[model samples]
Target: MTPQSIQKTWWKEAVVYQIYPASFLDSNGDGLGDIPGIISKVPYIKSLGVDAIWLSPIFASPQKDMGYDVADYRSIHAPYGTVADVQTLIDRLHANNIRILMDLVVNHTSDQHAWFKESRSSKSSPKRDWYIWRDPKYDALGNRKEPNNWKSIFGGSAWAFDEGTGQYYLALFLPSQPDLNWESAAMRQATHDDMRFWLDRGVDGFRIDSMNLMSKHPDLPDGKIVNPDEPYQSGAEFFASGPKMHDYIREIRTEVLDHYDVMTVGELGFTKDEQSVSEYVAKDRHELNMLFTGDIVDMDFGPNGKYERDDFHPRKIRTITNLWQNAMPKFDGWNTIYLDNHDSGRSLSRYASDAPEHRATAAKMLATYLMTLSGTPFMLAGQEIGMANLGKDYGADSYIDVEGRNYYNEVLETRGGDVGKMDDVLRELQLKSRDHGRLPMQWDNSPNAGFTVASAKPWMTINKDYTEWNVASQLDDPESIMAYWKQMLSLRKEHSDIFVYGSYTALEESVTGRWF
Candidate 1:
C-alpha cells in the first residue's frame, strides 16, 4: 500500500501489550517465565484484540536491570529459553495475525558482556573505547573523587572505579550496567548488526530502551545541583539527548530499521519539550515512528527525588496532557500512552482510588482517559486485571531492582538506621516504585498464581489477591477490567478517526478534576 493509502501508521491505531518475559509465564518447572510459556498465552493476547505485543528485554543477561543489561544481543537468556524459542513465538504470533516488538537496549550492556570485559581488561585494548571511561579527579588531600558530579539513578555516584585501569567509568544505572560509548564507531556498527539479526528473523519492530540516553555531551559538564539540602545532584542534562543523539539514531534507522517494514518507538527519559519529540518521530525522518515520554510519570516524584504525597492534583495532570497534545499535531507522529510499565508501579494503586471497592471503576476511567487519546495504547502485564501495587509488607529484599534496594538503604542511612522511619519511607517508595509492576502475572488463583509449576518459587512474589483478580476469573465476566480493555481495544481498532488520527483537546483542567 502507498504511504498515503496506509490510512495511518499501523502503530498509531494499535494497542500494544507489554510483557515482562521473566514474570509473564513459566512453561518449565523452573520459577522463571520463558518464550515457550509466552507462546502458550498467544490466544489470550489475541483475545484482547491488541495489534501487537512488546516483550521486554529477553536477551542474554545477568538480570541486573531485570533484562536491560544485555550480555548477548544475538541470543536469548537460558532461563527464558533459547533463540529458537523466540522464533517459535514469532511464528505463532504471526499465525495469530499479531505483530511483535522486541526491546532494543543499546544504551548499555552488562559488565559481564564480552565487549565490556575486554574493554576493562586493559586501557590499551582495542575495545577500550567501547565503553565510557575517564580518569578520576583527586582532591588536594589526594583522595580519589568521581569524574563528575553526576548521580546514578540507583542513588549514588554514576561513576564506578576500575581497579585495573585506576580510572572511573560512567554507569547511569546499576554498576553492572556500564554505559556504551556512542562515540565509538565500532560499537554503533555492532549494535546495528544486532538489530538486523532480529529483523531477518521476522520481528515486526523494536522498542528502543533508554534510546535518548545513548549519547552524552563530549565536555561532560556538571549540571546545576538538583537539591542543595541533599548531597548529590541529578546530572540528567549532561547525558540526556546528548550532542550527537539525532545523528546516531538516524544512522541506526538508515542501517537497520529503515531496511525493513518496521516500526520504531523510543523511550525518552529526560525530555520535556515538544520540539525534541517532533524531531525524533516526525514522518520521513528514518529515526522513529513514536516515543514514550515520561512527563506524566515524573509528576509522582518531588524535585528532590522523593515521593510527592500531596502533589498529585487534577491541574497537574491536565498540564501534562495539554503539553503533549498542543506540542505535536496529531498527524506528525504517534505517542505511546501508558500509565504503567515494567519500571513503574501498578496504575491501579498509583493513579486510581486504590480502595478495593472503587478499584475497578477507577481503572476503567483511567483506561478510557488514555485509550481514547491520539496515540498507541500500551498496557503492562496484569494491568487488565486491575492489579494494585504490592502491599507494605513486601520488603525491599524481595525485589530484584537495584534502584529500589539503593533507595531503601538511603532511607535507612538518612534516618540514622531507625527501622521504623526507614520502614515508612520504604512503604511510600514501594507505593510509587517500579518493583510493584514486576510481580508475577496473575493468571489464575492456583499456586504460584498459575504462572509456574506448583513446586516453583517465582522470581518474585505473586499478588496476594491473584485468585480474585486474575485473567481466568475476569475473562468470563463482562464487567471485569479485562473485558473492558478488550472492548476498548476493539473500539479503537474499528473507530480509527477518533482514536487514531484525531486531534486532542483538553476539556477541563483545575483543582477539582481533569478531563480530555
Candidate 2:
C-alpha cells in the first residue's frame, strides 16, 4: 500500500529506538552513563533509520528502580546531567532530524517527591490526598494489617505502612515508589501540568509507562486470587485498566495531548483478552495514538509464569502476532511492535539462538519478524549488534537491576533458602531475567566495553563475550547482526507497501527439535 492508500501518520510509519541511559555510555567516567555520552552518539543513532528515540526516564531519581523512581520530574538526574545538558542533547538530536520520546512514568512517583513528602507529613496536610493513604487494618492481636490483598510487583505488599501517619500508602512497585491517587482531581491536574511541562520543552512524544495502572478501584477491594499459592492476586486484577481509565485518558488528551502534534503511546500494564488495547489507541477514542501489548512477549512463559519456563518458540510468537493483528482491524488502533526492551532479556538469547554459530542468523530472523509487522517497531539499544543474555555464571552479587535482585530473593525465600532451588531460579534468570538486558553496551573489545574508562566500573557487569560481540567488530561484516538490521530497515523503507501495510499471514510450520 502506498502512503496515500494507507494511514499516513508519521508515527505509524516510523520506527522507535529505546535507550537505557545509564548503560549506554559513561562520559565523566563516574561509572554511570550520562547525557553527554548520549549526545556523542547522535550521529550513530541517526544512522539506524529510526525516526525517534524513546529515552527511559532521565529525571532526578534515587536510582532505586534505575531512574523509574523519580524524585523530581522537571530536573535531570545529577548523575545523568544538569537540565542544561538535556536541552543541549535535545537540540543536537533535533538538529539531526531525530525526535525524542520521554518515558512518562505517571503511575507512581518517588516517595521523595515533594508532593509525597507533604502528603505523608500529617493526615491533615494540604497534600495528604496526593498519594493514596488508607487506614491500616488491625489484626486480632493488635498487629497492624494491610488494607488490601494487593501485592507489589517487586515482591511484597503493595501497601507500605507509615508509622508517622499511622496509615498505609499504596506503592504497586516499591515502598519508595508511591502510587499517585488518580481519583484525586488535584493529582489529575498535577499530572496534566507535568505533561505540558515537557511538551513546552519540545519533546516529540511520550511512551506512557504503566498507563493502564493509573485508575484504581475506589474502595480498594481484594482481587480474585488466580493461584491460592501466590501472595496476592496480581494487583493488576483490581487496578489495571480500571473502571475510570478511558475517562482519564480522554481527559488528559483533551487537556494536553490534543493541543500538540506529538505522538502518544500508552503502555497497557496488564493482560486482557478483550479488545482493551484497541480502546486506548482508537482514533475516535481521542486518547492515545497507539499502545503496547505484552501478550506476544508472554507467549513463552509457562503455567508458572517466567519462572518455570524453558524457552521461546517462534511458532508461538507467530500465533501471538496474528492474534493481535486480526483482533483489532475494526478498532483501527495501531500496534507497537517489539521483542526486547530494558525489561526483558536479550532477544538473541531468549527468542533466538545465542549459540556462537548461529547468533547473527537468529538475530536477523528475529529482526525480520519485528520489521515486517504492521506496527511501529521499537528496538532496544544494543540489539542491532546481536547482544545475547549475560552468562548464567553471574550470582546475586553481580545483579544490579533492582527488580532482578528482588525476584531472585523472592524465589529463594519461597524455596526456604535451598541452594539448589536458588540455582534453578538464577539459571532461569540468566535466560530470561530483566538483568539480561541491563548489561552495558559492548562498543568495543576494550575494558568496560568502551562504555566507560578502563578504571571505571560500570553499574552493571559487562557481558563476558564483549570481545566477540562488540560493535567495532560487527559494523562492516556483511553477515553481522547490525548489517542485517540495517538491511531490514532498508527493506521496510524500500517497500513500505508489504512490510508496513500488507495484511499479515503466518506461514504454517513445525519443528520437533532445536533449530539450527
Candidate 3:
C-alpha cells in the first residue's frame, strides 16, 4: 500500500514481534531455525495479532556475532535456508496480513564478508576504506599498541592487528565483526544499496541493528577514561552517534526508506537522553519511525562492572516508565518498547517474579504494563509463555555467543579460579547474557522442545521449564501469559485511540497499582 493511501501511521499503533531466527524454530531437521521453519510458524505468529514480525538477522553470515555479522546482505545463511525460502516466508506473512521487518546490521559486517575480505587484502584495494583501518600507535619500546584506549563491548581491545597490512582494524564487537567506516562515500552507497535490495524484494520494514553506531569521529582520538574502578572505559562519545550521523540517517531516509511504505526502528545503545532519542525518531526528523532505547535493558547490568551484582526490582520499573513519559512530550517520535531481545536474558526470570506460583501473575503484570505504554510493543520469542533463564550448570561450550564464552574463561582463569564464584558469575551472566534469549523455542513439552528433528543436540539447550511453559499448553489456558498478550494486542487493535495515538501519562505515581 502507498504511504498516502494508508489512513493511519501503522507504526504508531503497531505491535512488533521480534524473532531470533536461530532459536525460533528448526525445520529441515537441521537443529537450527531457518526461513522454512519460520514460514511454518507464521500461523502461530499471526494468531498473536501482531502487526509485524521482526526477524533477527537470517542473512548469510559466519555466525560470529550470530547473524549480526552479515556475510551477504541478499542471501540467507546456509544453515538458515536460501533466499527463495525468505521470499516464501515473506509471501506467507503478507498472506496473513502481517508485515515482515528484517534485521539490518549496517553498523558492521562479518570480517569474512566480501567487502571486509577485499578491504583487508591490501591497503590499495577498492574496498580498502570500506571498514575502519588505523595505523598502530607505537609504544616507547616500539611495541604496537591499539590506536586508542577504546575497548570492545565484549571486553578486551577494540583494535585487531591485520598481518596482511601490518595495521590495526577496528571491531566494536567480536573481531569477526568489523566496524564499517560510514564516512566513506562508497561505503554509504553500498549500505544504502543493500537496503534497496531488500525493499525491492517486498519486505515491509527494517530493525536497524546498532543503527546509532554508524558514524564515528573523523579524526579518531583517544577518549577519556570513564571509570577508574573498571579495567577499560568505552570511548562511546567518540564513536556512537558521532558527527554527521544525522546527515547519514537523513540521506538513507530520503533515498531508500522514505521512498517505500516501510517502518524503520533503530537499535540505540548508551543513549539515554531525551534530545538524542528525539532527534532520531521525531516525525519531522524523517529518520527512523521509531527506535529501541536501552534504559530499561541496562537495569540488569551492574553500574560498577560486569562482575558486580545489582538488585533489579519493581522500583527500577519507575526509571523506565519515567523516561518514556518524559520523552513522549518532547518528540513526536514513537518507541519500540521491549523488555527482552536477543541480547538479554529471559525477561520472565530476570524482571518478573519467576517463582512458579508467581510467574503467571508477574508475567501478566509485566505484559499489561508494557503493552499499555505508548509506542510499538515488541515481544521477544517465547516471552509470551513466561520463559525463564536456562540452568546455571549449562556450560560455556554450549553457548553459541563468542563474548559469553570469552568472559566465562577470563573470569575463571583470572579471578582466584573459584568454580563457585564462576557459577555466581555465570548465574548473573545468564541473567544478562544474550544466549539465554537465543535458546530453542519451547513449542511443546516433547523431545527437543519440538524445535527440531535433528536428534543432534540443539546449539543451546532449551529452557528446562518447557514442560509447563510450552506454547501448546499455554494456548489453551485462559489465564496464560500468552492468552493475556493476545487480549492486550486485541485491545491495541480495537482501541487505537487509547492504546495507540493516545498520550502516555504514568498514573502509578499519583495512584499506586494503576498504570493508566
Count of clashing residue pairs in every prediction: 0, 1, 0
Model 3: clashing residue pairs? none
lDDT against the true structure, each candidate: 0.83, 0.84, 0.82
Distance from true position, residue 307, model 2, in Å?
Answer: 2.2
Q: Estimate the Cα RMSD of every predicted model relative to the unseen true structure.
A: 2.5, 2.0, 3.1
- For model 3, the stretches where C-alpha displacement exceeds 4 angstroms are 1-7, 227-232, 392-400, 508-516
TM-score of each model, paired residue for residue: 0.95, 0.96, 0.94
TM for candidate 2 is 0.96
In candidate 3, what are the lDDT values of residues 167-282, reduced to their tens digit?
Answer: 99999888888999888899899889999998988899998899888889888787687766554568788889998889999999888888899998888887878888899977
TM-score order of candidates, top first: 2, 1, 3
Model 2: residues with Cα > 4 Å off, grouped in runs: 2-5, 226-231, 509-516
Candidate 3 — what's its lDDT?
A: 0.82
For 1-516, candidate 1 gives per-residue lDDT tens digits of: 112433466767678899999889999879988999999999999988888999999999988788899999998899899999999999999999899999999999999899999999999989999999999998999988888888888888888999999989999998899999999999899888899999999999999999999889898877687577765678888799998999999998788777888888899987878888888987756578888887776666766664535456656667877777666564365676878888888767766676789989988988887788877888888878888887766776666567767787777787898777765566666677777878888899899889998898888878787878888899889999989988887787777786776777676445654444
Better of 1 and 3 by lDDT: 1
Estimate the overall C-alpha local distance difference test score of candidate 1. 0.83
Q: In angstroms, what RMSD does candidate 3 have relative to the true structure?
A: 3.1
